[model samples]
Target: MTEQKQETKCITLKGSAVLLKEYLLYGINSILYQRGIYPPETFEPAEQFGLCILMSTDPKIKNFFDNVLGQIQEWLIQRIVEKVTLVILNVNTKEVLEKWDFKVDYETVSSNGNADDNGDGKFIEVGSKDTKTIQKEIREVIRQITGTVSFLPLLDCLCSFDILTYTKPECDIPKDWDETDPVFIANSQEVKLRSFSTSIHKMDTIVSYRNT
Candidate 1:
């Protein structure tokens, strides 16, 4: 009998960015679906990161996230972004109801010089972490997002959502991206979710809702 060997899957800086982007995009969709932000029919289940994730299917919404996450991935590679937030607001009153924040820590990669932008303006691979571990962490985060409805107050009004990115003050802003103030909920209750690190980047998640 021949012995079987197991192969280790490694994560790179670029890979970490990709993973984080997917987490943001899919994670938001999961929240929206679980929280009734949109019609349940607007989303469909898709397997990702070894989990059955709900993905937005509306073309307009899908295109919007593509542009948003694409720019985020670029910034992630440059290590200039500090955090990304998802703000859900009441349509009529224009009041913030919920906020989902994903905080990024680049210190690990920065200390190793892996976050520096190459002359070619691309992320260079520096180190790797086991892919299975990363996915396990992501799965837990998604699970938490789905479970949030148990405690979050019912959103009684029509709601809309916006994406906000926090970056270095001196970072060049793209023409398509606009500057905005942070949207916060009043008398908010916050729940910290599971965090995942790819050795190059670490992401911490928190969800805040209006305590009404």
Candidate 2:
């Protein structure tokens, strides 16, 4: 009974992927709200990671995240996604202003779910960390994101946002996916935030803004 109870607490690759997707969902919404890309009234408060997160109520924005992050979850399980970026830019001039990057690193998982010498370098089916602890780490990252508004320069012009996902070169690009040049901010200043690991995948976040 003890072993069975402990087994239920194991974090699997799919579970980690789901958690990653949720973090992106909440993090992006928080960015949108904090940066004032959308009107503050368009978002509603919701509880996540023990924090009151403001999620977008706009149907279009909601659907966009659902579809994009849904696909990202699958790729994460496959260990193919490299990074996901949220780019904020001026709507009129189309100049890039700020970028938030979520970088992923794949970790080796043992076959028996134990980190033993006998296990070969493959994939982690069952991870080592518990869900509760991971959520706590996520809470801190989100808190830092909210605090960034204090230092990040104001967007004086009308602005909009877009999400970009970087994948391994051999990844199978979906027919609906279009290739685009990488977005960059000239004379950018970057700040790295705290990282969280699921024992299967490690995530690091960095935010860069044009030093105007």
Q: For each candidate, what TM-score against the reference?
A: 0.88, 0.92
Q: What is the lDDT of residue 207 in candidate 2?
A: 99
CA RMSD per model (angstroms): 4.0, 4.2
Q: Tell me, by lDDT, which candidate is best.
A: 2
The residue ranges of model 1 lying beyond 4 angstroms of the native Cα positions read 1-9, 109-123
Query: 1-212, model 1: which lDDT tens digit per residue?
Result: 12221124335677788989988988999988988889999889999978898888999899999999999999998889999999999899998889999999984643333344556644556545677788889999899888888888999889999999999877888898889987877799998988888888899999998777
| Candidate 1 global CA lDDT score | 0.84
> What is the number of backbone collisions in each predicted candidate, taken in the order shown?
0, 0
The lDDT of each candidate is 0.84, 0.91
lDDT string for model 2 (28-77, tens) is 99999999999999999999999999999999999999889999999998
Best by TM-score: 2
lDDT of 2 at 165: 93
- Model 1 CA lDDT for position 62: 96
